[model samples]
Target chain A: MILVIGGAASGKLDYVKSLGYSDSSISDGFIGEEPVVYNLQALVAKDPEKAPGYYDELVGKEIVICDEVGSGIIPATREMRDAREATGRLCNRLAISADSVIRLVSGIPVKIK
Target chain B: MDFLLTGGAACGKSTYAEKLVLGFPKPRFYVAAMRPYGEESFIRIKRHRKMRAEKGFETIEKQTDVDEIELPPHSTVLLECICNLVDNVMFDDQGNMYDVTDRIISEVLTLKSRAENLIVVTNDVGSEYSDYSAGVKAYVQAIGDINIALAQSFENVYELVCGIPVVLKGELR
Candidate 1:
């Protein structure tokens, strides 16, 4: 899966849509429950050996879009830190599996694998 | 938190995203959702990649199910274009439209919750003319709902008009 990162108004969504994707396929925050979120965390909590099924379940999905939280300094609250840590781990894992990666700025796309 | 960028077509969303990514101190991943199914698509993808040279991005072409992929931590993820990805997946097989929509939404939310810095690119389809095919209408409605959900979930949301960003939430400057 691929992840997208950019600042506000950077055209990240437009670029994805231009590639023929609808809004549903790009954002990670849908109206209802999402399977990947639960599965990934479960796997991390239980370890790969205990959650082999979860590990096998997430192979070869296309272009997973994630919002970037690294643009500024770290959060002060513990809950925020935990959220950031989870997000950081998730992005790192997806990046390694992704065939390529892209970054955007001022509505322009930059390819970084 | 998630970052969402929405705007009209040809409003320079891609260009803006490239600049932001370039500003990062470390290298990041650039995910291009365009498949280039025809000559026109291929040319367009080529042009986009070429224009992004200044940002030093590596391009990955994705054309598969998005639900089964895994992401790494601490890395920047850029997804260029959400509309096309939905179109490709929704019609991939002779599947029911509702099923496709459900899967798409689920996958997107999953990605957002799991990724580090997820940058999303999508167009503002709600403001366009309403006269369209039945299928097109359904797609637009579905996408509108999805966009609203994304905006609500993300900490940062921006609307681009005439190549300029009008921040709707969070601190962007």
Candidate 2:
């Protein structure tokens, strides 16, 4: 499994695509061959409980891309904060078993294993 | 063993640091830098405290003056954040960036000396180009400088990318 992470507009998806995984292989919502779970935070926002199960199924199988959305000023609303924390927790779980983890800073990939 | 953990907000720096400290010997201390300023901060503090509970950690709440705090001999300490300490020291006073950065670096060095192992947590807030006010920009600069100094001094530095620990300086144990 490979995990790709970066902030907004950090070109995480482009970096993953450069690795040879085409658009057809990457799945935005459903799990598939080379599933690219871009914006994992959105899944948490929609259903926090189901998010972890989705991550569990993707371990060692999917290529994940997510924004580092936890930073900046703390959110005012409770729902937003919950979503942020849930996203962070889910990422931690995914990273522990991931074969490789890459961080993209301004479209540059830095390997973090 | 000195460890420096940094990442964007909510990237799981705190959770990873907490896990790292457990690898060392007992008498662990969690040095919390954030104050309960308002509702959001209070919620964060509560969550962090809950996370640390029953983890064999003794929590020490200090905004600044970290060097002045007494630690048990040969104990491991986790500084929950460096940016909050910077804010506490620089928020009221209009000090120059160099002085503030130096102050923080000095304090971190002192703490490092006192503890057998120090796990320092910091946020990467300067990565993005922002239209924030002058004060915020200065704050970001201070954090960036302090991170560099600490990373150079500490044996290990890990940047958490969406909860994934990426080692930039030294290996993680």
TM-score of each: 0.55, 0.81
How does model 1 score on DockQ? 0.02
- DockQ per candidate: 0.02, 0.47
Evaluate candidate 2 and give its CAPRI docking class based on DockQ. acceptable
Share of native interface contacts recovered by each model: 0.00, 0.54
How displaced is residue A96 in candidate 2, in Å? Answer: 3.0
After superposition, the stretches of candidate 1 with alpha carbons farther than 4 Å from their true spots are A1-113, B92-98
**Candidate 2 wrong stretches, greater than 4 Å:** A25-34, A42-61, A71-84, A97-99, A105-109, B93-99
How far off is residue B161 in model 2, in Å? 2.4
Lowest summed lDDT window (length 10), candidate 1 chain A: A30-39
Candidate 1 lDDT (Cα, 0 to 1): 0.59
Candidate 2, residues B56-150, lDDT tens digits: the string is: 99999899989987988989999989978987878764554334898889998999999999999998777655587787877878888899989
Clashes of 1: 90
Candidate 2 lDDT tens digits, A1-113: 78887788888889988988788877764555555766666667786667678766778566887777777654557787778777777788888889888888789998877
Compose the digit string of candidate 1's lDDT tens values, residues A12-38.
777777777775553243212222221
